[model samples]
Target: MTLRAYPVRYLPGEDELVWTGGLGVTVRFTPGVEPLTMADEVDLLVVTPEDFSESLQPLVEHKDSYGVATRLVTLEDVYGGVFFEVRGRDEAERVKYFIKDAVEEWGVRYVMLVGGRNGGLLEEKWWCPVRYAHLDDGSNWEASYLSDLYFADIYNPDGSFSSWDTNGNDLFAEYSLMSKDILDLYPDVYVGRLACRNSYEVEVMVDKIITYETTAHGSEWFHRMVAVGGDSAPRAGDPWYEGEEENKAALSYMDDFEEVTLWTSDGSLSGPQDVIDAVSRGCGFLFFDGHGNPMNWATHPPHDEETWIDGLGVGDMRKLSNDGMYPVCVVGGCHNGQFNVSLLNLLKIYEGYQHWYSYIYKGEVSPESWAWWITRMAGGGAIASLGYTGLDWFATGDGDQDGIPDCTQYLSGFMHVNFFWEYGENGRRMLGELHGETVADYINAFFPTTEKLDYKTAEEWALLGDPSLMVGGYP
Candidate 1:
């Protein structure tokens, strides 16, 4: 009676054993002996680099205290084949395979990726590597952008791995006029990220999550939802202020929360100063409907003059004094969620700006995106933020061809406003549930692959935060 571990594979003549136990065995041997398994039954799985393992323990404990049944697995653990066999073309796919295994064995509902680049603003290294989707919307000159959705959409419809590499060319989610890879955009599990470069940032986030869950319930500030916008797309023949209309639609679902409108039509959204003042005061949630880049989030006024009314920037993060009262910010704009921005790209300026050059790579801008700056703010900022990692598009006129106007659709507005709809109307309290369900709902309604813009829309939208967060705190 000895024990040994072997990679599960199909035997040439042996039939696969079918069982209803806590394991998925591909083959069985050794009569009268049960196999060992990692069947701990996890509700939330935290994946991070070994360096941040100690820093994330508090978050693990806090989640457990709230009956979440959390588990923390390091990159080293998965790569070393401690719990699952290593497989995939790259590290990103390997991590995704681990997620699939977790779902099948431990029944994980939420996953939190807890690491980012390893060095300072100038020097960088990916601790937890990300997958870049090559879904070209024809307008995206860069052709690729970081997407965490690949990790969440673990399985395809028929229980096969949703590798996002359908064409088998190793180009994941590649979509062009000539080459295309069909994908099951629906998420098998909800996922989020903490893009922390160091342990201090990890500590900051852990404390924020713990405090928010333990103390945020029934707070008056938590009852107020702040909606800020102007003219997101000031187009002729379109409405004078489309952003305000979008915000109003989002506010319609959140009827219980106090509506704090700071729109340009009301003379409230004049500049960044107004936004800073409001954020400093704090609120339960913040919806910023406008145009944005990695450096800043801004929009035009009520008319179609195209005058930019600045809302927030990475530099203004220090002015936030709301402290523990962080809102889950949903910014509707382009590149606000582009977490792949690197300061090291500044050195490449010697190469003249070409087709691949994105404006976000400017040397003067912050290395991190606006939404990340908000989430990583030491004391006052957002607990989480959802936005597009690339060029976000709104429906010009019934892009879906559903007969009804496109503005009435879900992703056409703030896009993530469906997150609010999930929470307010559907009663999805967990942050990731709202986030994942929003994506799933979009996929269900749009049947994505039909339009390139639709496919890019779902792929680029990303959530940056803990996925298992209890919305409005644990009451």
Candidate 2:
């Protein structure tokens, strides 16, 4: 099939509005490129990287106005370059994966592929449909691993490279080994780890780890790795030892509230009974700190006894079980705030009333930060009443002895700004009163504002905030 490329140029010296009108009609005509002129075919519009910005503007406007799903294809390898340009490589990869999936679903072929510095030597090759075909088949193309690899040598604004090998390698090796073992047991299963730079690395690691007659081994392994059993495991212990002081302080703050209920155990409460009871008693924020699986709820061992015989696991959060005054559920766990299909489904089951924030990483969170987050909510700084706290490092508020621990405060402040600026402008202003200027300013002032912020500085800045803050409270 011959692909017709549509190029929209913002001609200089020409009337911008007129140019936009002409561009819109030109884009509208692009749907005729495919042989099968179906609704789905019309959905796919291919454009070069140069035109991506302009082309997407119209599509975004159209979608907002009419609620239509129009997929756009950019030849630019947004994911591959992301590791070089951004910090969260895993997120970058996820975005890329999502784009690929959307393109495939729209029945589109070929994207104008560009190469990044670490995109490997193969990326230097000219854009070819065969290369695109290989990626589609998952045969000859390189598989994604995680964001750590791409950001292994992040660049500084002054052209210096930030070495993240020491930290990243260790994490990657462990995750890789674990993935390999899991794939070895179940060869057909898809195994992937989320990476930095908005990407996810997925590759077939092993041949098999499970076999007949070894059912016990398989079961044990599955339970250990995948099950969300109660908080008995070593990993379930509070990872933030630095947060002892802040945690104490937060507990002190909680004393002012009526009833502070901390759901530290794993697994879903039996048939919403606990939730019902809490609601009946008019409980405050429902705080859940425990292990969680995307599809199964595994309570701590002893509590499992109370579970229903046919009760739903994590997968059943979308189904009806109990109805009453619902308290906002704050899931201090991973991937709970994905804002994707799973969360949408969860919304459906809860009659779209339950507030949920999920997908919290353990390392980037702290008791103190959690306390501050809830305190802000209780203080009426926010009205959404539910949402996941973004990634944060667990640390004591007194580690640096300024007020909040530098890392915890910075991340908390950043996420607060990001969330409020995007979703709650008023909330952002209120948070600003507590934390001062926005996270973007904080990041740019101290950290290297280059294509790639050196991972070392990134990590350091993540901990210490702007270095100027170290000298004085005012930057």
Q: Give per-residue CA lDDT, model 2, range 1-475, as digits (tens).
A: 2222223221111212111233332222344344332124423232224332352344334432333333443445443443223223443333334333434345322221211112212122212111110001122212221121122112222223332222443232122222310001100101111101111100000000011111222221111100111232222323332222222222333322443332323234443344334333433223333322233222333323343222123323323221221222333222222111122232333333332232122221111222112211221211112222222222122333444433223332233323223222333212112122233333433232221111111221111010011010111
lDDT for each candidate structure = 0.79, 0.25
**Top candidate (TM-score):** 1
Off by over 4 Å in 2: 1-71, 74-313, 320-392, 403-418, 421-442, 445-475
Instruction: State TM-scores per candidate.
Output: 0.87, 0.28
Q: Which stretches of candidate 1 lie over 4 Å from their true place?
A: 1-40, 119-124, 353-365, 397-405, 408-410
Quick one: how many clashes does candidate 1 have? 0
Candidate whose lDDT is highest: 1
Candidate 2: residue 247 lDDT (0-100): 23
Model 1 TM-score, 2 decimals: 0.87
lDDT of 1 by residue, 1-475 (tens): 2223323321111223222334543655453354324466899999999999998988888899889999999999999999999998888989999998998899899999987765444344688878889977767346888889999998676567898988799888998878888789888889999988889889999999898898889988888888888876666676536677777778889988988888887789888788878888879899988788888888887665658888888887788898989899999888888886766666555556751264434312457887887998788999999988888787433443445334545354635567778888988889998988888777765562356777777888888999999978997
